[model samples]
Target: MVEGIFHVGEALAAGDVAYLVQAPETLISPFGRDLVAAAEANGTPVYPVSAAVMGAIADKDNPQGLLAVAHTRHVALNSLGPASQPWLVALVAPQDPGNVGSILRAIDAVGASGLLLLDGGVDVYHPAAIRAAMGATFHRPVVAASFAEFAGWARAGGYRVYGTSAHGRADYRAAGYTPPLILLMGSERQGLTAEQTALCDELLRLPMRGRATSLNLAMATGIFLYAIHDALDQQGYFAARAS
Candidate 1:
């Protein structure tokens, strides 16, 4: 369970809340009280606890006076964005929860279609990932699939798969980002393997000019996110995500 008020609020807005725990501190805060009222309206049970008890139950170091538990929404590969402009970010076996969360934030920031977690990686709902993601976790379509499943789906969907790698020959800026594509980011410890990279239609690389050989996973993904948006906007191919 997570303790941030806004996070819980987002959960409530999405009708994803199972329940909520309220501490005395929230009684005095306007938004906190609003959430409790919203919870009641939604028929979600609310449990009141002392701050000490809240601290004991919450995962955050400093509890936000509210804790919300919501069922995870398992988005399917076929149910992702529109086939015409299905720009997606796929992370392969990402080990860091914080990185996954930050990448989700980046996805929301750039208005990308969705995120796909391939193979096994940090859960999209891990507390750390949720905390790091703020409330963006509840806003996007997140799916989990095996690498093979994803590859097959991409082919069937006519997607252009672009893998990101340090050794990739094509510069990220120069590469074409046609719609219905996947930007696959490999694990932080071990980037895309040769075989994995081979699955992509092309491999994209960011420039390395400084002593630092690589950029952090979230940072690289953000750079790419913006670049794709800029390119699409310039080409008049950009559209606000369809509801």
Candidate 2:
């Protein structure tokens, strides 16, 4: 295969070859060179693009030189399971690609199993989301679906679904975030709905220490993910099994 530079949107849309993004060594750089080098050492091709193209991906007020590409990777949700260690974050009707990407990064950091993006949420394949994900997309399972279908599957799979809401009785930190748990985050402007609210096994709320009413979707997700990670560690979920 010949090496050539391409736009993030164009390369990802083509979807037939692996791609990598290379950003410059600047404060505003969208990606780290170490990440690009790592992908290359692992057999993934990496290309550096002109700053103008990088700007398109990063949404800079003015263009700069930075970008990379390779064939995109394919992922299957069931590939990560017995559905035993199932920890999923559900985004229903989220409109911002940046928020989706941030949440995916958080999921990757905490070693979550997968993501179930409900209908009306931002497109996972959107270039902006991909950029925001900062390469975590390569390591996480994120599948898009309608809320109805996902909720039904969650029930059938015996997942203990928890929704975040202001009216929740329990603090988010107090919840048991074990395996087979699904954390649901609603839209940015409005929180969970009556219909969706009814589907949750329980409702949870984050405590406002500084008097802020709520947290950003991404921040809330990060907090909950770390909480889940802490819970898993406490339960010896990270321990090796005996033969």
Candidate 3:
């Protein structure tokens, strides 16, 4: 079950919200009432309870007036073929759930095709990750696979795989990022290992111009995702849509 207005609303829009539980006072607001109407239109059950009752169902100090039950949405690796997502970001065994969610949000913000959580990472559905994503998890295609499996898929689909490193010789901006590509980011704890880096078509690094030698996993990944996007834009990659 997902909690909060944003998460529930996204799930409702995705047609997965089965039922809703709301606090009595929320009906006075427009968004709250609209959510109830949407849920009802879909034949979803809406239960109104006192604030005290809501607190019992919620994980937070404040229940935020809503909680919802939604079915899990799974995205298969094959479903994310080249056409489905021209660019993809793969996270390797991310230790922190919030970082995973933030990266997922970044992927959505930059219009990347989807996210790949490689190896055994935090559950995407974990409330912390889902909450941090601010409902982005509901619509984006998220696939979980081992590094080997993901590598094979990328190779078979003819994708250019770029791995990030602290000591990579290639600057990310100079690397010619093409579509049907994957930007592979390392784990929060250990970054990328030698074996993992070898699988990549190229290795890239961000400029450490300041005292800081590294960046937060999500922040670094977001930077790389946008860099690739801007490069594609400069190449007139988005022109076809306007035409």
Best by lDDT: 3
Please give, for residues 1-243, the per-residue lDDT of candidate 3 as tens digits. 788787888888888877898887744667867888878887899988998888887887766788888888777888888876888899999888899889889888887888999998899888889888887888788999998899899999998999999888799989999888999998887888887898898899999989998999989998998899899888887785456
Q: Which regions of candidate 1 fall more than 4 Å away from where they truly are?
A: 81-85, 239-243
TM per prediction = 0.93, 0.73, 0.94
Model 1: per-residue Cα lDDT over 1-243, one tens digit each: 655888888888878888889887644678988889878887899989998988888887777788888888877777764464388899999888999989999998887878889899898899999988877888888899999888888888888888898888799999888887788998888999876888899888999998998889999999988888888777676554433
Residue 231 of model 2 has an lDDT of 83
lDDT of predicted model 3: 0.86
Q: Which candidate number would show the highest TM-score if scored against the true structure?
A: 3
Could you tell me how far off, in angstroms, the CA of residue 243 lies in candidate 1 after the best superposition?
12
Which ranges of candidate 2 are over 4 A from the true structure? 1-66, 69-85, 209-211, 240-243
For candidate 2, what is the lDDT? 0.70
Task: Quote model 1's TM-score.
Answer: 0.93
TM-score of 3: 0.94
All predictions: root-mean-square deviation over Cα?
A: 1.9, 5.9, 1.5
Compute the lDDT of residue 65 as modeled in candidate 2.
42
